[model samples]
Target: MLRSLWEYRHFILASIRAELKGRFARSRLGGLWFLLNPLAQTLIFSIVLSQVLQARLPDTEVKAAYPIYLLSGLAAWTLFSEILNRSTTIFIEQASVIKKIAFPRLCLPVIVWGSALTGHVLLIAAILFVFLFFGHVPGWSVLALPLGITLISALAFGLGIILGVLNVFVRDIGQIVAIVLQLWFWLTPIVYPASIVPERFRWAVDLNPMAPLVRIYQDALLFGHWPQPLTLAVPALVAAGAVTFAFVLFRRASPELVDAL
Candidate 1:
């Protein structure tokens, strides 16, 4: 699948460009929408909760810590959600092309990565600028940002493709995933901190796979600290398994999946 996808790299690039263009085709702001939507959400959260939970920001030294904490974790969440949400129905979205085109199906997800990566690169840059303006440079821990982003992407794409494959057969899976993500988002510690959760209920929050990834971002981007590798080991292993399993499922189901699409 890797070799086949590489062989059809042009299609992936073209698809990514076309997808971005089509997404904001007639808008005056164009690509700015990608930056605006998430940042706008950040503004609302910043206004509502910045001071309320300012005390729970992991004892970080950064100024404007809440928004940085919020935006930093959000960057990872946005990337994961974009790929996962898109992957859920990517085939269905391109059902017409899938029916007619004889290209590799893996290219679809690759295109999703490219498009989302482009937007996220800009998002990170914007975040960095905000951090600098506030005199809260990320320092060396900033290097770990890519690792956290990659892990979250792998996890999201892994889960997404698995569902995408199933959704091709069962359209209801797509709707179910949307609801699950909403619940998952609240369960995550993005808008709030985990320290405030009661001890008895903390187990479920700890069990959430995204909890560690968000902490990885918070540690790296907001706190300027290297997350303990041991702390990340479990989710890293799970993400690897998710990717391996997704590939197996994709290979096994591609024939029927194409027909169903």
Candidate 2:
């Protein structure tokens, strides 16, 4: 599958470019809208939650700390949810291509991930700019962001392909996914700090796979702290194992999935 994707690299790049153009084609501002949406969301959330949840966040010298904290977590969460959500129906979205195209079937999800990553890059730039306004520089720990993104991307992609394959057979899985993501978003500490959760119920936060990933982002961007090597090493191992399993599963089921479509 990796070799197949590499061989069709041009096709993948073309598809990603077309996907971006198509998404912004109708918007007056074009691709700027991608940056705008997240900026607007950060503003609105900062406005509402900043005051209400201000007490929960740690005492810090960083100006506009809440917004920085919120946006950092949001960055990781956005990439995650976008990939998982898109992956769930990517095959269905490309049903015609899957049925008629002779190229590798794996490219479909790669397209989804690439398209989403394009938007995410824009958002990350926007987030870093916002940090500047708050008198925060990109700390040395910011260097760790790529590794954090890699871990979560692998996790999301691994889970997404699994659900995507299952949803190809059971349509109801998509419906359940919507609800699950909604609840999952709240369960993770995107808008609020994990510190606010009662200690007794903190296990919910601890068990969530995305929690550590979000913390990695927040720790790097907001607190200027790099996690211990062991902290990231564990998830790195898990993500690698999970992604390999997902790709194997996806490859094995490709023929049947194409027929189902």
Looking at model 1, the pairs that clash are: none
Model 2 accuracy (lDDT, Cα): 0.84
TM-score of each: 0.94, 0.93
Q: Kindly report which residue pairs in candidate 2 clash with one another.
A: none
Report the error of model 1 at residue 261, Å: 2.2
> In model 2, which runs have C-alpha deviations exceeding 4 angstroms?
52-56
**Highest lDDT among the candidates is held by which one?**
1
Steric overlap count per candidate:
0, 0
**lDDT string, candidate 2, 212-240, tens digits:** 88889999998899877765665677778
* Candidate 1 displacement at residue 227 in angstroms: 1.7
**TM value for model 2:** 0.93
